[model samples]
Target: MLHETSRRRLLTGGLATLAGLPFGGVGRASTLFDPVPPLIPIRALPDRIFRTTVCLRPFRAAGPRIESERVGRKLVVHNYGHGGSGWSLSWGSAEVAVRLAMQAGDRDIAVIGAGALGLTAALTAQRAGARVTIYTKDQFPNVRSAWATGTWSPDSRVAMANAVDAGFADRWEAMTRRSFATFQSYLGAPGDPVEWTDRYTVSDLPPEQARGFYRAQEVTGFLHMGDRIADISPRSQLLPPGSHPFPTPTVMRNSGMSFNIAMLARQLTADFLMAGGRIEPVTFFSPTELTRLKQKTIINCTGYGARALWADESIVPVRGQIAWLIPQAGVTYGLNYKSVSVLARRDGIVVQDMGPNDGFGFNDTNETVDIGAAFASVALLAELYERPVPAVSPRTDP
Candidate 1:
């Protein structure tokens, strides 16, 4: 419980303070002597918005369930409940899930769901010499994972601080590192499936004052283990006044990897199929239904669908919505201003309202797209670029 106003400030300031700190990827650093490139302002007009999508991030207080359980005669390895970090922690989480599934000593493995976690788990199983088959109701772009923010946010709302045990941090760090390393391999892949880009965090308040808002959020009980693996990604650096193009007095910049979901999904699905893996259109209503599958080992990666399919009441739904604008050339970076965030992906420009606090949409399972909210988020970005850019002054040695 943070008040609405405080929560809004927390969302804005917290992102500027710790946005890309935990990402592990390749990026060039900016120096004082280097010339600052002019940023291509985002065209955030309502006419540019082509689609709106809503997704419920499966959030579990304790963190993702990565243990195995007996489902009748079959062994089901649970790998769901990653909250907002599903795409961010996929590879690493899959490593743990696949490891557990392999313990069953089964040559064939069945992966449930076809989202980020499921695809990664399927690929991980294939790499482990297991003949994998994915059983999912929908795949790729049709699934909820495709609606994600598509940024490298490894620890974003992964768990609640008070709800996790002491050992959770170590496991999270391991997963983050593994996921980061896996992303590097796709850096130069076709379609630019994974690549690093700059993110500018703009704030109207002064830097120190804005960070105070972030300090307030720290006591709100959200698990922030990004510091544990801070070495993995580049740190957010304060932009020198007049050296950056923004209407705001405070501007912080960081670089991290992003996934172009449209391209990445195509690549992942193709990789899975090319590796002799099979993906069947199958849906299960209960754990007992899994016993009918031929594979004795299974990795359950149903994501938000697990809340009903598995009857796990612990899984809370964090409602998130995104408004996609037509992609613009030369607009490859990201921006966070107010409570709104914009990411220019290969497929489209993603605009999102991150809400006032971590609990902004907690326990809210409504997946209906909010047209007004989507337009409002884009309007904020429109207002940002409308402001006059301050004149740059010559720098002098102190």
Candidate 2:
């Protein structure tokens, strides 16, 4: 695990470790803004085989007792590991975790990591009338959640799935619905320039063959093999065009809309501040560190941070890199085929086609610029979308 930052800050309870700074340069990120902007097209490798991989279980940690931790002599809630669905399940998981956090019955609460999960956990706590504080390394825009292709698909990620009780899935389903409702709140402001692009996912056979794909296809896509995806949804609209210019046989809304992750992270930060949530912006180590916390209860929302401070092996990084194309800004919809391609709002036609071998490895060392590879992929999508999308990867997870 990349020790976010070797520098540790002294806190009242335990010490906090600052997240490792971005790879741009030492301490200062010189190439911070290299990926965003008046994005223009780039040349990628020709017929290059690109392997875009994400951890099949990105958030599942082999623990040093993270699921069971001590905090100020109170019960701590374990609410991480939604993988790509962290944002999608933010509210639901937080609701359950916060319920546990609240059961501790403390007036003050502590939240770990400030990514979408952390922010939502903090907000949920605050709403419950508990004063919440976030201890984090790299604030919002820097956390992994901010880099997510912000949609609503819980596919290709872990969420206590194959986890404990059957109730967990029901709980997740309810939360998913709740999250969709909550996402509506962050609509226009923070830059939801991207929205749910409802298009048909055509398969040669019938819908049953491709049933599960659209179900978990895009974590952000509010799919409704039975609903609608529109600009303005009466109830998170799900629109299905009878037949487009394509040959797509299977179809559903990828989700309601798309989001500029960086911007949404910023928006979430603002929401947290507005809700009166306190942020110490510090790091922590050792369970003994709780003795110094101003709050009695703590919520550990750290995503990958679990590996270091808690020494959790489950939170390993499924190294992923995006070949960002110049934003076809005019293009607001998104398309995803497993981990192959995603044309998002901020990051244009970005693809991280990691396969089983080198693609899925946790070596964040695959930042190759396969501009032509990306170009060819995008062109294919253009052709696909102009008509009907072909049968997608039949795999359950992306």
Candidate 3:
């Protein structure tokens, strides 16, 4: 097994050297991002599972609504429906939402929801010299954002291509670039909340076949909009079997950002508190409730809750589930294989199946654990690494 020191070498010196060669059928090195280290193979499954949780990505076809509305004396700014990009686009979205809320000329702000978007909004507003308070049904640790895969996936199921606004690309690109810049500020900080990792896309087929495989999912109209802002993030490139490290026959690799969800939420919440922001365990059943708050300006970062609370029928829930195993500290990278993704995080190793199609999770609000899918994803990874699929360990009553 390669050590951490070797992994670093592969990512920096080794990969960079390979970039100068015409490897992976690419005629030139300029086509690839700086060489990235491959994920260390998982040798064994954990004796105990850590957790399984589901999150309904608040999806909207027209993209996130950042408009302001008048509710009695309160000026409410809607900042929900980010779909799976909630964490990835939090800072940029929050910046836009708060900027709009600031136009109300209110010295105080109320941000609903305790997820990534909410915390970021509260902190952003507070930094602008506004007294901010977060009102949510659950605290940071209990929010649905905790269940996300935590990758910098700005375009993941964000919208149907035809449904977005005419100028959506420009707006979306601005938010993505800004968010990418802001996220960098948190890198190398405490808790490894924000960090870079090599995310490999492994397959047995050739590059063309793999592209065809992914194209099958794109037929659903959920386009991969990563290219719009690809300049800000690393780009993926093919790595032929001979040069790849995974036991798989072929692989593609890229270095991208990831958030340790728990660590990120904890640190953001702490930063908000230390900056004189207050959070109340409060839930609003309807839009009218915003009038009850003394704060005249409200920024709603409620995610999927907007579907009912704000009567936003356009906001759809794309439910996603993840099965987590005990943390493999030695495994510091991630992989996308067989329509399933596995990421090594500070909290745990996350295994999730994206299903046969990209839209498989569309409108699926069911929170129940799909043990079959979870286990199957693990089995797929086990096969890729040429390791035995571990037997199921008995579960204990909670």
Candidate 4:
């Protein structure tokens, strides 16, 4: 029997071998020599937690507002309210907003809000040969986008199934694919701004028993459009009883890209400035205030701030919080055990409680960090490592 430390080293070696292959290449039989999969423990303790942050995701029942409207002499293109998908869909949504702004035949484009949407829009406009200027009150690190979960969740809380039109899925697919392709360009760059990592879902219950978890969490019935772009994402593989090292009875694994927001933000800011794009520290009290800008075309990427800035009551706030643990070397995977989700990124290890259901944070506008709640999530994660490893069945294969 392999000791805990030996198991981790073997797993790390297996992971290193699998890392160079494509996303789903872990399925290769050569990597399955061990009867039981290796385990890499997360040092999830209260003392290791460095910080906690809270952010409000702007959710619209009808989906993100990507339309053009006349605001005095300016053609304002609205591109906010992407909910939890802002980071995942920013590039594609930027493509749409820039297309609309360019239709106004303006050479100088102004982007409001320097969050994920704003930076991407400014960069995309620059790519379109426009002189872009970002007008915002705060820059990266201080912006709400900096507090995002930093995962590839394109359709997460993006829209309501009943509220959107029939054509919305097609548009969503285009945005997801475009954003996915653009993220691919950032791979292999310094600091690993964007890269793929394997994620494990650990559960005590079997697959059939856990199928109803989604139904229990749906409060507003948000649309699940992952199926539309299924071709791009790798399929989840169920780890056999003896093939995974977890206290839980069931484990499923999948590979997806995660963003190291701090690194990605720096890269994006440098890209925008190098391309001759400018950022001005400015704030707008209302839509009519946009007329004061010298650029005739403006893209509004205000996110949840739009609820007050535009008096848009339709934009609901979905609250989320992250508890950051000091980065642990060689811990590069993600985990979902119980309600807590943990991702090991270059910046920090992110631990979050997804709430009781999909509606756990729906319509919540609170931005205060709950230290107790954050610690509770860390406690839950610690439970996985504290419990004794379960016995595995013998391998039946030759």
TM-score of each: 0.91, 0.64, 0.87, 0.90
Per residue, candidate 2 scores C-alpha lDDT tens digits across 1-398 of 00000000001001001123333212122123122112222223333323332222254522112244565565566776665567766776777777777775687888878887888888888888888889887785466675565555543344332333545445555666777677777666635633454322233433344433333333332111111212223221111223223355432232344566766777777878898887776767865675677676777877766666667666646545455555554555444332344544564444444332222434243434455544555455445545533443432322
Instruction: Choose 1 or 4, whichever is better by lDDT.
Output: 1
- Reference-based TM-score, model 2: 0.64
Give the Cα error of residue 373 in candidate 2, in Å: 6.9
Cα lDDT tens digits, model 4, 1-398, are 11111112223323444455554533343354434335578898999999999999999999999999988878999999998889889999999999999985788999999999999999999999999999999998999999898888888888998999999999988998999999999999999999998777767876444434434545566787765776786655555565667877656666768999999999999999999988899878988888889989999999999999999999999988899999998888888776778889999999988877667787887888999999999999998889987785554443
lDDT of 1 at 286: 89
Candidate 1 on 326-397: residue-level lDDT in tens? 999999987878778788999999998877655678888788888999999999999999999877666543
Ranking by TM-score: 1, 4, 3, 2
The clash count for each model shown is 1, 56, 0, 2
Report model 3's TM-score to 2 decimal places.
Answer: 0.87
Q: Which model scores highest in TM-score?
A: 1
TM-score between candidate 4 and the true structure: 0.90
Worst 10 residues of 4 by lDDT: 1-10
- C-alpha local distance difference test of each model: 0.82, 0.50, 0.75, 0.81
Better of 3 and 4 by TM-score: 4
| Model 1 worst lDDT window (10 residues) | 1-10
Candidate 1 C-alpha error for residue 96, in Å = 1.0
Better of 1 and 2 by lDDT: 1
Worst 10 residues of 2 by lDDT: 1-10
